[model samples]
Target chain A: MVSITSSRLVRGREARRAAPALERPGVAWAIPGLVFFILFAIVPMAGVVYLSLTRWDGLSTPQFTGLHNWWRFFSDGQILQSTLVTAVLLVGNILVQAPISILLGVWSAGYQRNRAVLSTIFFFPLLLSTAATAVMWRQLLDPNFGIPPKLADLLGGNTDLLGGQKGAIACLIVVTSWQFIPFHTLIYQGAARAIPLTLYQAAAIDGAGRVRQFFHITLPQLRNSIITSTTFMVVGGLTAFDIVLLLTNGGPGTDTSILPFAMYQTAFRTYDYGYASVIASFLLLLATGASLLLVKISGYDKMTSTMEGL
Target chain B: MRRRRNVVAGFAAFAWLLVIGVPLYALVNTAIQPESKYTDGGPVSIPSAVTLDNFRTVIHSGFLHYVWNTVLVAALTVAIVLLLGVPISYAVVRGRGWMTRGVFRLFLLGLAVPSQAVIIPLFLLINRLGLYDSLWGIALPTAAFALPVSVLVLSGGMRDISASLYEAMALDGARPARILVNLVIPLSRSSIATTCVFTALQAWNGFLFPLIMTQSNDTKLVPLGLYNFVSQYGGNVPALLAAVLMSAVPILIVYLFARRALVMGLMGAGGK
Candidate 1:
């Protein structure tokens, strides 16, 4: 025990001496970046909370209102409706995109020429900004001139795609899915490629057929990718406003208004900066909670910084 | 049985292909067709007459200016992300202090904080700094939002450098900067490339910030330009589609030219 202690101490001293070459960078190295991030990001996050307690329009001073906005948010039926729609959109997007991307991702991992060619086309949507894509889809969904009239059979003869609550929400989901599936598929593709041939060979030797092999092996191997992709979908779904603003603009009497859109309209359009900050605060809580859950579930906190410290 | 399964898979894949391809085809088909003939053929029809007038119209009516603005925003965002992200990532990777660790955690938490949530305070902050309508307004906040992913990607990369390489550089009396330049930078080229592509794309594709912050034509980004176009060219659907197609052209150019490197960089974001 004494010898072990002495050896450990000696090794520790050697490690300290050796590590200085790289570890010599002090906290000063991170300060510039940290300051920039804090000023722009962290400061604004804190400001949202402080501003939530005040009643301020753009021109006037932010007079302290003492939880007036929060009270309103809890009581307001519109906000309750917005929260439900937000949850609906979030679940809708994940359900629609997750399975399709996984199947596409696994298939596209093949070395087949057709798969490669098709996937290259699949990536085209990622190039367009959400704004651009949303703009294009808006035109496509036009009741008079767009594809809705042409494909009335496929869409249940609903010419007015944006006229009703369910139809408008469906359009949002369809457009969002089309735009984001390629990105998630790329994630799954990368993960699928990293999966070993040996595992498949072993599964085949066990007489596991193609479908069984996929369910037993490929699905299990894609665990991390599924989590990563779903995290993106959830986070993205929660703050989804650009597409909402461009496509629906919370039309049909706020039937499609999600939380972020509600925040945007309240702040910018109505000029209610205080109540907007309340919605903003709630968004912050949900987003931060999501990221916290992601970190905890994915062991992401253990993944990077913990690699440094003793 | 195997042949039947392949057929089923092929049919499903083809159906998906149509779902993706039809919209893209419509985008191009409408853009090329004369506006007068757009409704006659609907979206999926073959054009009676192809025209480039829409593209010309888009360029003349300040689309180029918006594109140029977007280019500048992307450049500034990439520069700030690299300049700040590299050293911060290095510190997070190598520094032993709790401060560095805390900063890393701060960024990690930043990963999911959507820029949409903070627009109220951000608008206020930008206004106070008198950068409200400027391109700097967009780039600064954009760079800040992008830094989380940039640092995450870069640090994940910087950690993979072998200790021996650093030790070797240090043995020659090299400091951290020189060692970074000689050892870490060279070794981290792929990740740096990934960072550049990812950061530039985020800045390029950024919408909410540019929308709330800048309203004038002088600072209009392509995405916002596209948004405003919806109302202005709302009647002229073909011209609007042309502009949307034009917005994607630059990225499409990169995809065509540096397909492999671009894809690898793209994959870098996902696997993380």
Candidate 2:
């Protein structure tokens, strides 16, 4: 009986060892997701690429136009202006949004007892849809009854933040930063909290003050999180559409129009499907290239390993 | 020095309150007061009379239909995301081979391709399939765009599960599917919840897709509905604010309940 049991056990181990190689169940498990992705994402992307080479109104058959759309995109001043606007927003986000969020994050981290309440308050805007945010700000910036105008009234100046060209762009940047700051703040805060308390204690014993400790320990430690957040901001700025669209409609005569907004208008209003695809493709390339460069610069592989460990 | 630090901290807290509190104050303050109060005292006036009239107006104008549509779309998108995201993440984590690696890479590529980039073709494809102006049309693409992050988070969650558990399960003659159901699903519950909330938020907040894909008023979601409300009721600031407040309430409630999962999930995605 003992011999028979041992033989059975050995056979079971052998079967189990062979099971993985023969099972191939991963393919079955992964197919539904693969199908959905291909149908919606991959295939549509391919269609964009194809349509970029052809001029097609929605009503008519697409005619092969070769590089006409690309050439047009190069010469088009509006498109170039939109690109410039997007670039400005990206730079503004990096310069203005990042520092403020980092400071808030650092401050929030220092005040551990009130962290939750502070985070909730700061992050509230993130939960509001872009549409709601845009409307809220539109109301707040109304030249007559809006808060900014009211404040401007108090300050004795006439400022229509969303009406003029430069003002509109600036307002868009401020509102976008306002909505997104909470997200980046949380990232920075998480990074801040992860730093060893021992490091701070050691610094204190060494006679380092708060400012010195922050600059020395906290800033260096939060480098990866900063890079990550900046990457998101850049990407987000490049693709900014909903808030811009709802708030200004890329308007006061195209002052606030970004690339995506221009692409959207070209496709839907002008009905230039092919040219829109070209713009879309261009934006895609820019986003992908910029993100990869940012990730490469920031040592994304190291970040991923650390994240996985978390 | 400690006293000064307290002063600075108190100032920071107050600054935050103004930065965040003022807008919420405006939204709610405008929402509760009557239209006459808004017009008479402007936005800054204290409300002498609180009224539900604005909400009544919004509801009477078929606001609930739009709300129902958004809820349905969000729910379906979440369901599809979890159904696909969970299993595929498991496969990517547990399966070994170039196919699994390649599949994971493919999903990651989805992250780079923003919906804005592919929306033109998505629009055409939806029309071609005769799904234009349908809620499913909007939900389908939203789920696809949401999948990359969902899979990333779930796979991260699954990887956190110990190898010993898998080995133990396998030693008991359990199949991969059985292991997934019994072990992986229960273990990755937090990640799953996170994905659900994240995807639902995306669906609820989706504007561009619904804007381009669906046209008729009957199919309008909240974002689009809010936009139309602004255009239609451009003069009725109180009524418009009421609609905005109502549209935002459900998601705000969700965030309140699932604040930890939401923040953790966002951080996980950001870290990645």
**Who wins the TM-score comparison?**
1
On residues B1-272, what C-alpha lDDT tens digit does candidate 2 reach at each position?
A: 21235566568778877888888788888988888777556666677779999999999989999999999999999999998998899888888787887788788667777899999989988888899999999999999999988988888788788777888887776668778999999998988888888888889889999999999989999999999998899998989989888888887787778777777755647844
* TM accuracy, model 1: 0.94
Compute DockQ for each candidate against the true complex: 0.58, 0.56
The predictions' CA RMSDs to the true structure, in order, are 5.8, 3.6
lDDT of each residue in A1-310, candidate 2, tens digit only = 9966886686578687885443324666888999999999999888888899999998889999999989988999998899898999889878878988898887777655576677668888877888888888888788887776567856468567777888888888878887888888888887888888899888888988878988999999998888888878877887889999889999899988899999999999999999999999998888877777664776532313333545
CA lDDT, candidate 2, residue A190: 79
Model number with the top DockQ? 1
Which portions of model 2 show Cα errors greater than 4 Å? A1-25, A153-156, A294-310, B1-6, B265-268
- For candidate 2, give the lDDT of residue A261: 97
For model 1, what is the error of residue B150's alpha carbon versus the real structure, in angstroms, after optimal superposition? 0.5
Place model 2 in a CAPRI quality band.
medium
